[model samples]
Target: MNLEISIIVPDRIFLRDNAHTIILPTLTGQMGVLTNHIPLLTGLDTGLILVRKSVSSDWIGVVVTGGFALVNDNKITILVNEAELGSEINAEEAEMAFLAAKSALENASDEKRKIEINSQFKKARARLVCFNSIV
Candidate 1:
């Protein structure tokens, strides 16, 4: 049996497909889901979501910025604020953005500034990680 997974953002449905397994970045930590897995509902974190279409296939990566994931039956539904496919991201651009975010985070002086910069850093890092995973 395959897991039916859907990645959705406010603007659109990023992806809908069947997968052998998936790894989600949750508030607590990374969580792995497989077919016939028990029902679950968790808060998503800004990170990479890895999907394996089949046992012998390479993993597909998607960068998601915070939301929630619901698992029921053999279906997984992820609703995030924003999402980008690894293949759609420009490697050079992603790398540059990640570096810029990292630098900004390091220089953030105020608590509020640090928190905002940290979110950017995490999103940028997620994009870079997803891009690298698919390359």
Candidate 2:
């Protein structure tokens, strides 16, 4: 059996599909969900979400900025602030962005700047992760 999964952002529904399993980047850590998994709700982190359609299928990667995931009755609804499919990201561009963000974070002079740059660095890292997962 497959689990029904829907990913939504403020502007539109990013994805709706059935998957054999899903690995979510939660605040606590990575959480794996399968069919008939226990019902729960959790806060998401800015990272990659891996979805496998079936045992023989390749995993699909998605970058999510942060949000909430709700699992109930073999269905998952993810509402995120921002989301992008890995396939849509340019690997070279993502790599460059990641490097730039990393450098900026390292050179940050103030606490506020550090915090802002840190978030960008994390998001860039997540994008890189998603891109690499698919490649």
Model 1 ranges off by over 4 Å = none
The C-alpha local distance difference test score for the whole of candidate 2 amounts to 0.95
How do the residues 8-32 of candidate 2 rate in per-residue lDDT, one tens digit apiece?
A: 9999999999999999999999999
Error of 2 at 79 (Å): 0.4
TM-scores of all predicted structures = 0.97, 0.97
- For model 1, where is the 10-residue window of minimal lDDT? 126-135
lDDT of 2 at 14: 91
Per-residue alpha-carbon lDDT of candidate 1 for residues 24-74, written as tens digits (9 for 90 to 100): 999999999999999999999999999999999999899899999999999
**Model 1 vs truth, CA RMSD:** 0.8
| Residue pairs whose backbone atoms clash in candidate 2 | none
Q: Which candidate is the best by lDDT?
A: 2
Q: Per-prediction count of colliding residue pairs?
A: 0, 0
The pairs that clash in candidate 1 are: none
Q: Give the per-residue Cα lDDT of candidate 2 at 60.
A: 95
TM-score, cand. 2 vs. native: 0.97
The local distance difference test score of model 1 is: 0.94
Off-target runs (Cα >4 Å) in candidate 2 are none
